[model samples]
Target: MKTSRYILITLLMIGCISSCSDDFIEVANKETLTDSSFWQTEDHALQALTATYGALHGADGSKWTFFEEIYVAMAYRADDQINNTAETYGRNLASFSNTTEDSGPNNIWKTSYAGISRANQILEKVPNIEALSQETKDVIVAEAKFLRAYYYFWLVTGFENVPLVTTFEVELQNLFPEQSESSVIWSQIEKDLTEAEANLLTEHAAEWKGRATKGAAKALLGKVYLFQEKWPQAEVKFSEVVAMDYALLDNYADNFNGNSENGPESIFEVQFSGDRSNGNDERQVFNFEISPYAFGGWELFFPSKWLVDEMKTDVDANGDPSERVYESIFFDDPKSDMYSMEATAKIPYSDVAENLNNPNYFKKYSFNTDEEFYNGTNITLIRFADVLLMYAEALNENGKTPEAIIEVNKVRERGNAVPLTTMTQTELRNQIRHHERPVELAMEFGIRWFDLYRWQRGSTATESIKSTLEAHNKPFSENFQDKHIIFPIPLQEININDKLQQNPGW
Candidate 1:
């Protein structure tokens, strides 16, 4: 959709004009827009919203946000993936040796706030635009609210007790406000999503595929409740989303390849384009970073041996490994076809020389070609399968074990895995936590890591983080502490505002 083109143009138009020639001091610059002159039209409102979406990928207009560092920060702490590169920040995060001064947390903090600031600007200015209709303004405001909640979700989950800035700030004093309690932040998220669900459209046109929808808001609200252990509320939200028009794609592989983007399975996706030749650098770098060296990729991160073993434990109706194993990772399996090979070549995993020694490389998002490059594959943030699984989890927690089994079976059937028989609530919970989620959603986003952070397996939070990582044979399990669950506030941020206090143990 050339979304990046809009972002680039809007950034230039809205950016401040800091300098002018002395000879042209009296003349007005028609090229640059001031805040007073910009918020006068519907088009300007849309442009500003586009800039907010742009901040999702590049808040500072420098690097792809989820490409490398952020991905490592979100996913590496869990056991599924391991860092293979020598980057100090990535290594520190993976090993639990990070400090408040580390760049990984700082980058995430800055990028999320950048998005929040843009969203706040829209919430403050768009409603007053004289040229916009009330309906249009409602939709735009709903989207801004959703984006703000999405950004804050990352902040509160990743960095607990962060400052809550709902309004756009111009004054220096307002910019450096004190951090709010996590409970307060959660209330704001729920409020935003509830309003968003009421106002957002059920679906968007094909041209506007990645914008937030009513179903997306409901699903995210369900997730928020799930994280908070509010089982009844989470179940209600998820049940509403289940009633919406969405389903699992028949071919599980369709979820990852660029072929069926924004299809029935997607609730929301981060839109990316492969056509950088047009000066629109919106391509995603997941494939480039995770593919094996044989495919001309950097091999920055790959599936851990433990995850490969876990995927092999499940078998389909035909008494073979589940189809998800072959589809999700490239391991040394004779039955699995190597996606990087030519279609007619019939290359299997065992035949690839690179597969002989490596544990496994991520195959879900890798381009099915030998050449290494960025791709336009839209990263699905919330999909139907995930919602179904989460619903199952919530249902189980709320004493609906049999009903929850129905939901979990729906996802398992799609993956060609055997369905579960009746089991106790505790047994089913373990199955969902240890096997179903890790196998189904590994290496996608920080799902695994976030799951670990929220779960309390032992007597305390510290025990949960340590035991889970230790069970997975993570190298840094021994280094985990209570403070390791949520990252310390960035030292640079604290230095800028004395009101900010670092998280304990930093």
Candidate 2:
């Protein structure tokens, strides 16, 4: 029902906003702007652009949740790693382990397409502007193009084939181009990112602190290269970003704090604000991670035991798990036995009473006791640390172990963990896949799955995650395949677009 209403409202808003009059006085003469008449003013163009940002915020949480569900948890489940409330999600997805079409994947397709539609509207209309500065207009167009590429990348990465739409004609409806090859979609993504990298200025860092930046485009381009095994290019692009002024935050915890949402380390983040005029901002809905039984918020997701134990391990027998625990995972009581309680009953009632006070749970992204944007911390979509890690990945894949360790060590030093002086390709690859990503990118959506795919180690890593969970007395889900990797084409799209092919084995 909520999804239905969202679509209705979006269509209505698009209609009202697209049409505008040419003359200033003529604007008053028209009954309100409708989809057919609105793109007449610079202000109108700006408002439309802002709406795209708003959609981005919504897509962050919604898309992130699905990415985590299908890519990360399902792989862990297939590996028998941890049980999930989203077990239904894993089970349903399992049926398509080798395939990709189903009802479950529909929402992501719809959401992404909606974003593309908005971007197409801007790309088509922005050029005609005699009103806005050319520079301003160029950046806006770049932003839209950047987003279009981002959305298509998501589809291509998962489904391998996706429709490529780059136009502004509602009459072109039913123009379901058959699933374009992944290579074709990637070529388009590369074009957008390259243009975006060259066009975006670093100066917009203030007004658009969390929005896309040149560094963001460069970093994304590098990631796309890494995905395609274009190692040298990926290495060069990531190196370029690393050379830029961005650096990792001194404290890993600060990156997640509400006040520091756009910290120096964040290359790009989804800008979620608390200043919603009509309804609650879903972006500010931080309660999803908090324990629902104790607090009013729902503890809908929790860190997998595989994730927790791996971080908790003494990688070098350094006597302690380094200082990263405080930032990566939350412990309700710093004094409690984090590895030992037999059950919830084993937990002292005193601890239960002080549950809200307990700090043992993951608290890196916690809200302060009082703040207007309590749940509104901007979620970092890409950060310098991620860039560093991806750089390390490209270097390692290219068989440059020493250079890769340098990248890994840079991130480890921040955690106070000992860094490897050297490692083999296998060791570096394993560490990058199992340790570095989970710790560095924990709680951020889809990092795990993407890492697995890049390494082609999804099957083994899934098992490894499962084993750790089982040993720790945690539940693990099972049976993952290709369809589980991308997601089913959204049921709605399949219903509407005949040219669309369901992912194989769906």
Candidate with maximal lDDT: 1
Give the poorly placed runs of model 1, Cα more than 4 Å off: 5-27, 61-63, 85-89, 341-346, 354-357, 369-372, 457-463
Candidate 2: C-alpha RMSD after superposition: 6.5
Model 1, span 1-506: residue lDDT tens: 33463373333234455547766546456767778778889878988888787666656654455666666688888888878846443788888888888777787898889888888889989989989999999999999999899989999999979999998877667878899999999999999999998999998777777888999999999999988988899999999999999999888888898877888998888777765675657677776677666655667877887888899887898778888777888877778764542332435776676544366787887765233355678888889999999999999999999999999999989989999999999889989988899898888788888888778522212237788788888877798887888889998899999999889888
Model 2 weakest 10-residue run by lDDT: 1-10
Model 2 alpha-carbon drift over 4 Å, by segment: 1-31, 35-37, 59-104, 172-174, 276-283, 314-318, 331-350, 353-361, 369-373, 457-477
Error of 2 at 356 (Å): 11
Positional deviation of residue 185's Cα in model 2 after best superposition, in angstroms = 0.6
Looking at model 1, residue 480 earns an lDDT score of 83
lDDT of 2 at 384: 89
**What global local distance difference test value does model 1 have?**
0.81
Summed backbone clashes in each candidate are 0, 30
Q: Compute the lDDT of residue 198 as modeled in candidate 2.
A: 77
Give lDDT tens digits, candidate 2, residues 1-506.
Answer: 01111221232334323346555332333655665456767767766666565554344335344433433332432221232354354444433342334433454565566677777888988878777888888888888878888777767765668888887555655466667887899999999899877777764745556556788899889989888878899999999999899887787767875656666787877665544457543344443443324544344455665566677762434556655655566544333222112232223223555554332344445544333324456667788888999999889878798999999999888877887776788888878877887777766655665565545523322334333333545442244433345556665677778888877666
